[model samples]
Target: MENKRKELLFSREDIQNRVKELGKQIAKDYEGKKILAVSLLKGSFIFAADLVREIDAPVRIEFMTTSSYGHGEETSGHVKVVHDLNMDLKDYDVLVIDDIADTGLTMEFVLEHLKAKNPASIKCCVLLDKPSRRKTELEADYVGFTIPDKFIVGYGLNYGDYYRNVPYVFAFVD
Candidate 1:
């Protein structure tokens, strides 16, 4: 069965605990401010949703879809924005939420694009940080888990579009 080929990485309880902690930290950081939470789509949808719920401050949500131009394991940092932001970036603190900071190219591209709009301030938060595969020096302000270079799925990361709805994270076994 398909279940036999996977090992649990982060359980549902583990994810919930961490997300709660991150939410508290974020809320405390921006205690007197409003946050324009920009969530990178596809892989980040679920994590962003859960994360925002934990924040105690005023949070507004928006989404961006981006894809990196790469052929294989080595990710070329060039990113193409499929959907651009419609928010007025001048009024609030911008927080970019992503599923995983893999190569960092996509995050870098996104940050640069947002910087042009002149937000009050900008920061990145990711559910997983895979520093081993990073091609750029971008660091997330908040990271839930620093994972190894492995094929992980669940909680918004998909395994051929099926395992995304899984409550926890797991690694595929050969």
Candidate 2:
């Protein structure tokens, strides 16, 4: 096994600060509104956990696990919801959180699906946005970073379902 390299894309402090900023913005935007934070699981877990604690509002949390990368390090354009949320998203402002936005195909599909449920509003928030790889014309309401088009893993992101325990982002050289 190749020893994973250490690269500091976003430090712990950096994540904390940005999440606080996002929380502040979210709090302000959805003050007194029923907010439903729908986190794309296994990846956005850490980010969603931290972000929700910072928000000073009445918010609900749910998780959905969708996978498009089966045994590879890239997307397959097919997202499967391994787990689904149990919340009834009727009149809430749904905020979809993910670790990164790559092809946007999955995000687009999820957003459209949720929108059809007659939610008051729906938005997306991603920890990283690799716009260079986007195949769909979707944007995140809150993005932590606009990274170069490279395979990265850490801070809840992963490679081969590994390296997500790393606290910082590192380029995975395949």
Per-model TM values vs. the true structure: 0.93, 0.93
Q: Write the per-residue lDDT of candidate 1 for residues 1-174, one digit (tens) a residue.
A: 285688889999999999999999999998888799999988899999999999998899999998763324345566899999986899789999999999898998999999999999999999999999888899999999999998788999875547779999999787
Off by over 4 Å in 1: 1-4, 69-77
Please, what are the lDDT tens digits per residue for candidate 2 over residues 80-141? 77887665688899999999999998889889877877788999999999999999999999
Lowest lDDT block of 10, candidate 2:
1-10
Candidate 1 clashing pairs? none
Candidate 2 — what's its lDDT?
A: 0.86
